[model samples]
Target: MAKINKRRKRIFNMLKSHPQGLNGEAISQQLGVSSRTIRSDIKALQDALGQYNIRIFSSPTKGYRFSQFEHLSSIEHELFKDNMSNLETSKQRINYILYKLLANTLNDISITQNDLAEEMYISLSTLKIHLNEVKNILKKYDLRVTQYKTKGIKISGEETKLRYCIVDIKNIHLENEFFQDLIMNIDTDLLDDIIKKVLSERKLQLTDRSQKKLCMYIAIAMQRSRNNKTVVYPSSLTNKIENTFEYNVAKEIIENIYNQLNVDLSCSEVYYITQCLLASKKLIDVSESINKKRVKNLVNIILKEIHEKLSIDFTNDEYLIDGLTLHLNIALTRIQFQMNIRNELLETIKNDYPLAFQMGVIAGKIVEQYDNIKINENEIGYIALHFGAALSRNGIKENIQAKNIIIVCSSGLGISVLLKAKVEEYFHNRLNVVKVLPGYEVNEKTLENIDYILSTVPLKNIASDKIIKINRMLQKEDVENIENKIFHKKDTDLMEITTFFN
Candidate 1:
């Protein structure tokens, strides 16, 4: 049970990041394993981690995550953190190649296959094999590898897609931690200030994340502009947004950028920047569309459907409705225009906020059915945030049923009283510390009708699921184990609680 493979170690970290949970197919895809292999790995993980109170929770479709507990200390952190960071796997190499190609494309640089293979310390044949996987991934972003074998390889895609793919790769591979420095020769600090000032003037409000993303997009724009890789918007696309408030804001932003960098940005950039603003989860839209009624209806339908599917009524949640309405309306425009904004936290949301992410997935399907357009995971992650917030706001408390428990403390009465106090304080009304008994008094007559026996010391011949052997001080693992065993979420309310002691 103590033994674990490197793959399972990666699985542990992946599950940690994705508290929502991941399905077998998803986990298998990330780890490059089969569903059968994943099943065995999960079983092994459950057995290995059970000692540490790291319970693996798995719903039929919601996926797998650490059940209720958030922290899992990796056993190999000191031994493998350094080795883990290096590009050891084929997946890592593919990611490296993707980044190199995109980075080169961003700066209009080129490198031959020979040099690329040499730099990575991989053979030409191995690099070629990895390139096949790299090409498949790029195809999803509407990007292609170009000029191979002759003038060296470059990423051939729309300017916006290039930027999107650059961010997308970082999210797909957690080890790709260097995307923040993708901006070069530009003062992002000054750019941030300018964006804030322009946004204030326009009375536009953005989340901190949105603002940061805009800064990066604008920086890329500046760098790309200098390289003559300017994005061009079609007349039809330009016509739709050219006169909007966001357009005006984007125009003001570029004007400030020009003043800061002394480089003239193309007219298309104004629309490009506006698209970024529209694609994000904004606090205020520059202009509210006349189709606001339709968006409200969609939000209502989504909440109603979620209630039906999850049996949680969010129809009366005005905050959730309003948030979804605004988000979906912009999402419609984003999908229609193919804006493809990056969601940095999609994997985390999908794994960690499993229920909410499933809700988002459900909501996304409804929108897809309505608009006849497919929504990506990034968009669904944004939708999940709304549901996740609603879940938190309305969750109020864990639905706990009162349980009968006897604290079998071999220590003195004071120590037993202290353990009882800790149990009462931590668990509140969830558990009943019926009586504190010495080890001698823990036999059948006292154990009769006792739902659980919490002991500081080991108890012999008592191997029931209800037996909780805890630390003397009730450490985190002890608390977690007790919680997992006794604190069940039932449909009953606090008012309906009936304790054995009472």
Candidate 2:
């Protein structure tokens, strides 16, 4: 009778009461729609509120909530001010199916194809397209969807593989309130207490995100173990990690889980948790024992490769070298254990730092040659950040004149240096490269001395007209773009004028 969808009104009411927020799953369960549909409804609601002075804020781990709505009574009045639409985009439907399948996998449930399609309110043809995508994603974790004639589909893989899928699925919806709630229901209070004590005693500090992730993984491990699905590490690997301080901390945490949650952990479970801790950060003692010669040699090799490929010299960048070495130590541990770290700004980096991303790709090959572990895009993205910073530091000089410009390359040094060389060669005294930065590092403060921002990536939300996006490798089109911006003239006429003068 209200004309508002029951789900939309219900979600609004829930968020109104729970200021903290709720994940998609929590809203879906109450509304009887897929989490995918809930996500779409939230987006629609947010768009509808554009006329009002209200906003919806989402947390990477906490779902969504209303912002700028101080009066509680005002929310219900505005619940459906605009006509609510129920259009589910193809992408949203795919995400919904992924969520549903992963949820079913975690709970060891099976679903028929017909039932899945019916639940998602889609046709069999559309459902298959989404399922194919899900299958591809699952393949990355070495899991597969097997179907029986009578029984719909179930995820099949090793216990470890299944758990990794679960972890990945958790990461995919990091901002889901339902997932956060699930993590909270697993005796997190006691787990956090034990973690704080262990980390404090070890003098290790983790950022808030890192701390949340560490706790979540521990909780996940406990849950899986309670389900008799503990990860089994190789004997040699277990023996190696069992001697470390992290292992001791993990063992203590597991013991506490037993005492508080009544879940007993096998040795393998302890070992698996240790790998999670080691993969997250480097322990002081562990850092001290890292193969200095090997790390130094690897750094030198990477630097040399970067220089050869891009003509960007980072040999003198002590900060870059030190940061990279430290990162490598932690990265190797994560790689060894097949743990993946999220690069939250990866899209921004890729879009803003094409040159740097290329440098990362080349550098990744060099690391694989030396370190023997294949590097994924996420890890390479981090590598690009270091190079981007180093490129900026190496190029920026305060004495450069008013024509000074900073190049932003999200990928790293190779593109920055190449672009700077091209600009100097072509523009001569017209423009100068005072700095080259990654997108994430370029801020208002960094732009103080800058006349123009030449970037391979877009600088979103920046009001400055000085920002220019260029090709990763300077092309004729890119040169023309620079000419148009800097000279305010056609390149052909400008070149003719310079040619006549020469």
Q: After superposition, which runs of candidate 2 have C-alpha atoms over 4 Å from their true positions? A: 1-96, 118-123, 174-184, 243-245, 281-290, 395-502
What are the clashing pairs of model 2? 23-177, 60-175, 352-457, 353-410, 356-411, 356-412, 357-411, 396-434
- The C-alpha lDDT values of all candidates are 0.73, 0.69
1-502 per-residue lDDT for model 2 (tens digits): 2234445666777988878877777888887789787787787667656666578898868888888758557655665543223326776666666666666655678889887775555679988998899899889888898985687898788876676666767766777533443343477777877776677666654433455567777787777666676776777877678666677778887777777778777878888877778766332224332466687778888888889878877887776777677767667666876776666657766987777788788878988987788998888877776666565455444333448888776432333444565666566567867755555445677667777888877776676778888876577888888888877878767788898785
TM-score per candidate, chains pooled: 0.56, 0.58
Instruction: Give the 10-residue window scoring lowest on summed lDDT in candidate 2.
Output: 281-290
The reply for model 1, stretches above 4 Å from the true place, is: 1-96, 106-110, 119-121, 147-149, 167-182, 284-286, 306-312, 344-355, 391-502
Superposed on all Cα atoms, the candidates' RMSDs to the truth, in angstroms, are 22.2, 14.2
Which whole-number lDDT from 0 to 100 does residue 329 have in model 2?
A: 66
**Which residue pairs collide in model 1, if any?**
18-351, 18-352, 19-351, 19-352, 20-351, 20-352, 20-353, 20-354, 21-351
Q: Which has the greatest lDDT?
A: 1
